[model samples]
Target chain A: MNDPKSSLTQVRDRIDSIDRQIQELISERANWAREVARVKGEGLSAIDYYRPEREAHVLRMVVDRNHGPLSDTEMVRLFREIMSSCLAQEDPLKVGYLGPEGTFSEQAVRKHFGHAAYGLPLGSIEEVFQEVAAGHADFGVVPVENSGQGMIQITLDLFLTSEARICGEVELRVHQCLLSQRESLEGIKRVYGHAQSLQQCKTWLRVNLPSAECIAVSSNAEGARLARHTDDAAAIAGAAAGKVYGLKTVADAIEDRADNTTRFLVIGRSLFPPSGNDRTSLLITVNDKPGALYDVLSPFAKRNVSMNRIESRPAHTGKWQYAFFIDVSGHIDDESLQAALKDMGPVAEQVRVLGSYPVALP
Target chain B: MNDPKSSLTQVRDRIDSIDRQIQELISERANWAREVARVKGEGLSAIDYYRPEREAHVLRMVVDRNHGPLSDTEMVRLFREIMSSCLAQEDPLKVGYLGPEGTFSEQAVRKHFGHAAYGLPLGSIEEVFQEVAAGHADFGVVPVENSGQGMIQITLDLFLTSEARICGEVELRVHQCLLSQRESLEGIKRVYGHAQSLQQCKTWLRVNLPSAECIAVSSNAEGARLARHTDDAAAIAGAAAGKVYGLKTVADAIEDRADNTTRFLVIGRSLFPPSGNDRTSLLITVNDKPGALYDVLSPFAKRNVSMNRIESRPAHTGKWQYAFFIDVSGHIDDESLQAALKDMGPVAEQVRVLGSYPVALP
Candidate 1:
């Protein structure tokens, strides 16, 4: 049998060797990043705007091996964030989201920015984008769609009208709670929540509280805070928001749909650094000719690129026409993506890049 | 082009033909099921035991060709119920579940049963199985695991001790709502809900209703009912339940986790009809020998089968030992399953089949 002391020493030595290797690798990477930052500061930009293609190529190489618990996709996500942070160190970004306190958008902001940038909260959605365009904030968070409620038209309209680049995306699960100020279930008559919250719990409200008048507020957290002040009122909000507002939850898990989820968008003035599994959003207006829309999109389909979202909005330029907002897989730098966009040019009257960013996964 | 009226007529005729074909297919399936039931009934007295192998083969055929918006795995679930209902027509099956009203278990029962059977709500989990054994209920529903709180030990303990067959399973999303009688935010003092509901919203309650006393009741619906009886007290429950009990929603969506989901089990005396993706639960007691547990599970891993849940309970023989409840994928009738169970005979002091049922997807 091996001696106990020897076995313990041997294990510790192996761990120390692994730690030394990891530390060396990390230090080397940091040095390279700093060098790149200095080069960019000297007006010698090292970034490859077309780097997503190169990133995808690198990941495919690792995935084809299938050697470990870390899947190719996972490694790519980690590396993408690492590289993004490193590059952004040359020019740090600031983001604005809808909040004074807890909100889903705040979470989205954190998710997109990571620890690389500062997140600021504004009073309204318009203020969020304004902060970005006015250079107060580098990015903005806005709700795009909810699983049960279809698209958020306000965000789509903003994209159409605002010049801020759509830089990134995030998805958050929506859980609502009934919060109250009262210690007892006595004489409570008022309910408050965002309009969307009231709609999601419509079926339940119709049968249970037929006589109570429902009121819509700006946010669930605010509603909860209001409920804290009013003995007869309760707020409908996410459990986290309720906690922040210090509202007592009377009921929970109240969304009409069991799998209720919400998707949010991040907007900035600049494009995101390449992430392998990236998606680009664009607003395009095709020619009036029949099949023109098909012609503009056919190049993507033929190349097997997938489109995630497609929506049409009125041109709003007194043209009596509509423009399509399309979100498609593959960043603008990919060869196929470039070709597809090039092919689309002839058919499109206007084509605007909303920006490309990393994909969010469950 | 042909006349518009004639084209419309032809399209309508084609739609009618498709509808007729659908009806024919449904009838043919029903007839085959009835024939299977008849054959089984005739053989019941001649054969004391059911042929699980044959049942499994039939289910495998159904699963193989499943093209689905709901995956092939999810398709097996509905087919399992249809087959179970057919099998039950030959001999009545008793089911039990925790009840009074407005519990998620009730929804699980309806979902698994498909509105064909009567669901009896028992006073307790023990009563649910007792009713099944006494021929009062054919199956029982009990919450097993919650996303936020982990396992419901009482339910686990019952599975560890009881001999009831777990014939099927289902998952349901739970939502909570705050209910009240008042129309305006005025004098409310107390809040009511199930203990777990109150716990989930503890953070929310502290901030919103710091002065309000949170009281735990038997069920969310019960809380609502109680709240309805009092003027200032509010109840926490499902939105539907709140409406049914005539309570106003003061707050909603109060769970800590936004993606909160619950998994429930359906227990009956009879074995369930096979579904391709089945999970068989077993409670095992070993002599506390080294490698004893490993030996029992190794066979499954060797056969490429995955185990989903592993729980331990006191052996209840007034000893310091424990029994393990394991849930593994694969129908018990499968060859790999048979081999694993057969090999387990010598290693286990006692190996009892808690049940083999279709895994429910939320």
Candidate 2:
């Protein structure tokens, strides 16, 4: 018989060699990123060196070229992190998001900007915009909408006044977990989570921890923090929060919805150039007329620009007057969108192009 | 000036007399509601007596006829509550909602069904549907979408299998507050809230309670429960939650967004007739083709049936295939929508009319 031990050893050696090669390629990529930084000059700020459009383009290519046992999303995520790590070698990008650490916003920052980027957790979405506009942070990631909810009005309202521009978007599938120090559900005396989290997991909690005193806390991280300290207490939070607070997951994916996604926008000081596939957001005020909305919409529809979302808010300029926040496919630079804008100028009271950036990866 | 005290007393007496007259009218309305129950027969279930479409029509009329100091929205709300109270005199509508009590879902139930309706706080959205379907409850209130988020996938998915139909909608303006026993931010060493609530009030907390340890809990009411017990702890929750737990609001309306609204759907056993101004939700599956989405959308666009929202989800039947959830203006019974559906029949694999109900009161 053939030597089975020798064959197994040979396979193990091949695996080790592949890992080493992969590590070497990553190192080379980091060197290339540094070289690019050097070519850009040392005087330039980290924000200038970080090109969201360029990164988006590269990520798109990675997805397009991918065909493997690994899913496209997983492959893209890996590349993004690798790119983030390499970018950090030159100068870490400072990204701001609403947080006290371990919030979903923090997770979104990590997801988009990568682990190597410096995440500055701000107190509010307004502060996130302020920080980005003031150049305190390279970019700010604020939630724009939730799949289960409609829109984040505060973020939309900020865009009406703030000079911040949308550079990218991150869609995070929010998963809630039951974190506890106890090994089983029976030992839990109280359950802690954010109010929303509690509602999200109401069914699971009721089925499992029916009689437990469910408490509301500031954040999932906070719940995890409390759970860490108390043996009988359990928390409902994201797995990331549990990891941060060193708690064990008694149960996972406890959210009521299977696809609980929150869409976040990366806000920057200036609009980035298009990355082939992109989305344009506009803030428009229409003239008070019956067909004003139809007029605004017809331009896009005629031009074959697919409208992604439309939201109406109090114009704040006049009582009962409304401003429409519109998201449409195609970058502002696209000829079709340009033609649509040209057509819209006469019908709309005012049209403000918020930003044009790459769409979130599917 | 000569007899100011006498005038004040006379005004007080006049106010009391008006209050008595109002009470008599309210009593008379309640009696009529009982008569409605009696005419409908005692054998009918509570759900049978509760007509969401009828209530919607009445509320719309209330808004249209109002020409007073009170806003149209305020007027509609008062009439709704009064109607709800009257409906309860016949037989309290058993409304199920995703809850442990003091949650937003429960709030939605009360907002739509009113205080007199027996609010059955269920564990999950599925339970809500199940209860309503099994005839255990008159109607079930469950969150379908948030103005900030997209759609609740689980709810949509349930529509595919559940027999429950959308009866009405309730739009609740979500407001968060700081509740405490110590009465001030200085004494608060720990803050409790849901993860989302914590993030919502992140800026406020950072500015006000920078040093306070924010903890995550299951529900805001739970946090209030905790806050009620601890002198040094505070909770970020709805004002209702505070009332439920006997905690005083240290600060109110501290949410990051001013117009944060949650849209909940009232689901029942069968579809009700249209309320004139109505919305129809549809679940559609399109065949595998390049222009499948375009084909699905063209019918609505061509028919001038305004499409409100469209959401795509995994079909679950095939890998990478999708199913769409669409919300459109007008009822399924309306000619425009009916024609649109007829046109869509040839293009779509399947079309399911989930429900047609009144547009939510503004």
Candidate 3:
């Protein structure tokens, strides 16, 4: 028993030594990132100093090299935060997102850019695009889709008119919580939440707080704000909203669906170079005729290029006319995609390559 | 000029005469609807009394028969409301939706089922499904997609597990407004809105109320509720929300995107027979192999089924595995789709027919 205890102490000592080395290496990496930023700043603008594609490449490499008990996702996340902190040493990236703060959009910005980036919570998706286009923000993150809901039309419409390009994507798993000042659900008379949040948590609330009046608020954070002041009111919101409003979780993971995910796009002034594994978004208007859609898709199909998503929207120029937004694997620079684009020209009335950027890290 | 004025009066008299005939015909139609319900009640349950497929067929016919200054869309809407009222005279449908009222979901319910259907505002999408499946509500209306955002995962996820069928669909053009008790934007220290509404109206708010604090609440109606009580606060919401809360519109049509729209699904106990113009939604899981996605898509393409949308979601049964939700133009009962499904059997690991229903009227 004494020998075992002594060996455990030795193991602890070794771990302590390793942690110190790791900490020092992280500091060293930050210094190197600062140096790289300085060098880039000397030759380029502040916006150009941070290369999202390069960062994506580095993170991909981290995943490739990782073979551990910890997941590749965890490893990539750790490296991203380190890189973000390091990059902040020179100048923090200014990121705009749709927010009054404590919304899922804010969460997506943090997941993509990390905590080191300064988040500018704008009022709308258009503002996010405008800020990025005007260079008021280094980049903007706005939600393009939810796994449950089909699409956000405003974002797609903005892309049609704005010069902003897709630079990266972040998929956030939306989790709702029951928050309140009260310790239990028993005393809760009213529940406040964003309409969506309330919808997300409805089943749970029905099963638990059967009689509570579910009040729809502007945001989950706003619900939390209201819940904080009331003794009998609870709020349905994200855990972050709970934290923001200083509310405690009366119940956790109250959302009806376990895998409710929102997909957000990082919009920048220009498309970045491919990060080995990338996706290209295109806006296509097909000639109004039978098999027009089939003709538009055949080029990619014949080339064996995989399509990720395709959505049709009213072209707005004419009644019954539509514009299709397509997401396909590979960058525009790739040979197969280039060939596909060339072939698409004859069938499509207009084909605009929105941008090529790295796929969101899983 | 005297003759023209006299002729105008004569035209007005003719218009009044026509209006009287139209009103009597509408009443006659309502009586016939009630009579049809009585006949249906003899052999059918209350749930079967409302046939969405039949209603869709009638609406399509209305569009086909129209040759007037009123657009097909306008004509269809008017007929829909009439049908809704007629249906209500027999038995009002208890339609469940994500609501505390004044949410877009509520609007969709009204647009599809009309004011005649008793809107059973539920807490969540799951509850909506549960209500429909359990026969507590005659049908449930839930948002399946947005044009701006991609999919609502929870709704799709519910479809995977619930036995509810898609009987109809509603597409609503979302419009936001600034409502306040105050006369104008001046003296508004705070603006309250649902996060999405705030985001939708962000550009207008920023340009109009630069110094006002934008506060996110649960729903736009909730925001209106707050705004109604305060002189210095304004709410960004839909016109319905403003009406519900007794607030005047400070600014109208303030959404950044003119074409902001949401797609909602009408869920019921079982699939209704096909309308002439219909859409089929399928859930397919493919084998884990290269070109698997292509194999799944090829079947649809070869038959020229014309897929409307395709979305991939985590299968949840395993990590990195995906299940696809596909919308194709045509009913499953159609020969082409039937043949396509047969061919898909070999390519897909599992295939579930979610539902086949009428395409939403333009």
Candidate 4:
């Protein structure tokens, strides 16, 4: 056996060498994460695309190959952070959501980006898309529908008029909150929230806050924030806003419906190859006649493509007619989908593709 | 034809008769809505006892009997309003949610209650649930999970430790936004939002407002309202708050991930017989062993019951001991489910039922 001093020296030298290699490897992995972020970023800029699955797949592979104390899930989670940081380094994507701060839009951004994206609060749905279109940000997140309230008409109109393609989708679980500066609901003057939120809380507001005026805000988050700043003013928003603004919750769970939710769409510059479970959105104007509407929809009916949404809006061009916005299952690239579009050409005046994206679940 | 005056008189009498019937009918319907709301109110106070399907079915029947300009869907919608109003009147169920205002929690309340709920905002998750248990409110709403951000540990903890029961659920589409008091982010010095939101917007915050301090608030709504009140402060919230507070959006869609969403849970009194598609939650403690977990879960496997969630929390009373909170797809009253619980007795030190309720969806 070697002497104790000699053995210690040998071990120290080996340890030093290993530490250097580990540091180098970490730096290399970080660089790779940065590179991946750069590529993804370029695509996002020219076209709105964020491939979460692909990135996740890569992280999984890296974690599996690692022979360390960290578990694969933990390792992947850590790597996700590294990758997110890299993406941020590449290009910061600005998102516009209906706002004050604690609104569902902010929650949407958090759900979409995890903890690595910047959430921008916007005043309206149009402004959200406009920010993305004008290059002020990489993507726009807007609410398209609600389970109880139905669709957000303004968002549908944006889809009808904008050239932006639908890049992604997300489902958010919404919870309405009652906020007041006072500890109790006594002597409350006004209840503030979005029109939809106010409508949802109508029954409760009427019963409990019978004398209180129900004021509409642009977003639930905004209402919460505003309530924090005003005296005797109550706002309906998420609990997050109350904590953020240091406001007390006078009550909770005030919605008339129990299973409420909102579906949001991600819009960007370009579209991607359809994932099998794709939903396509389009806008069409048919001749203002009885069966003209039926004719435009016949193609979809014939092809057996399921129509998920069908809404009509006035053609804003001063024409004595309305335009229909349709959303159907299956990608535009599908044979039947193409055939359906072809068949609808003669039944209308104008047709535009709103884009195809994956279905979302919450 | 008869004399014009005499004919007019006859017609006027007929019209008056019709009008009297209409008024009586409206009053009757309104009263019925209140009664329905009362029945539903009992369900809210005891949410697990609330069968959404039953409520929906009843409301559907009411709509089917309606006669007038309103279509079947419209009639049902009106009935929904009545039911919601009635429910609010019953107990005026108060709820606590993470807030300032206008956050997804408010939206979730709207989704759950239809268009009639009394939403309350609180400073934190604990605060929200605390309101429910303390009788300050009838129920509470809080975010439990996110598509991008994963589980909300705080809510999980509340469920694990609190006396409140899981009554309902709401999934909302999250839409994030960027708002500033000014028109642009050019001179923004600070970005405000909840901690989770700040983390979600990390990439964008680092890039655009690189030098800006990202302050964590309770909710995004409050953050936006704060921004509205202060100069050089931008808030990440939703549009609702902006409309209420009159804040401008500077940038939008700044999340690192494009598909973001948050899932919220409704908490209230003990559950009763579930509606269709039920879920049961329970907490169990097991002896230390290699296959103890497997043994505890074996009952579920044997019964062919699908388990949705299984999480472990450190036992509050001991060190190195943990309690498992499990959610499964079966009612406790089911033979198989009861048998599973009986079988679990040997392996578990203690077992507590959280609740058994219908699977509410968006």
Q: lDDT of all predictions, in order shown?
A: 0.64, 0.75, 0.75, 0.66
lDDT of 3 by residue, B9-78 (tens): 4533443333333334444455555546554445333354677777787677666665533345545555
lDDT of 2 by residue, B247-345 (tens): 788999887666667889988877888879899988888867899999999999999999999998878666656689899999888999999999999
iRMSD (Å), candidate 1? 26.9
Which 10-residue span in candidate 1 chain A carries the lowest summed lDDT? A44-53
Model 4 DockQ, alpha carbons vs. true complex:
0.03
How would the docking of model 2 be graded?
incorrect
Chain A TM per prediction: 0.66, 0.81, 0.80, 0.66
Tens digits of per-residue lDDT for model 3, A1-362 = 13644554453344333333333344444444544544444543335567787778777766665544334554555556655665665446778887654456876886788655766766678978887887767889988987656688999999878878888899877788899998788899999988877877778888999999989987665687678789999998777556434578999887777777888899897877787899999999875689999999999999989999999987876655679999999999999999999998888888888889998887
Docking class of 1: incorrect
lDDT of 1 by residue, A1-362 (tens): 15644553453344333323332333344344554334334542222221333434333443454332333333333334434444444444556777642356765664444433445656678878776787656567898989778888878888778898876677777777777776544556888889989999887667656676789986564566577677888778876555434467777777787778888987777776566778899899765678877887898898777899898888775474578889999788888878888877777888998888767543
Off by over 4 Å in 2: A1-9, A38-43, A177-191, A201-214, A218-257, B1-362
Evaluated on CA atoms against the true complex, candidate 1 attains a DockQ of 0.01
- Looking at model 4 chain A, report the run of 10 residues with the lowest lDDT sum: A18-27
- TM-score, one value per model: 0.39, 0.45, 0.45, 0.41
Query: In angstroms, how far off is B166's CA in candidate 4?
Result: 34
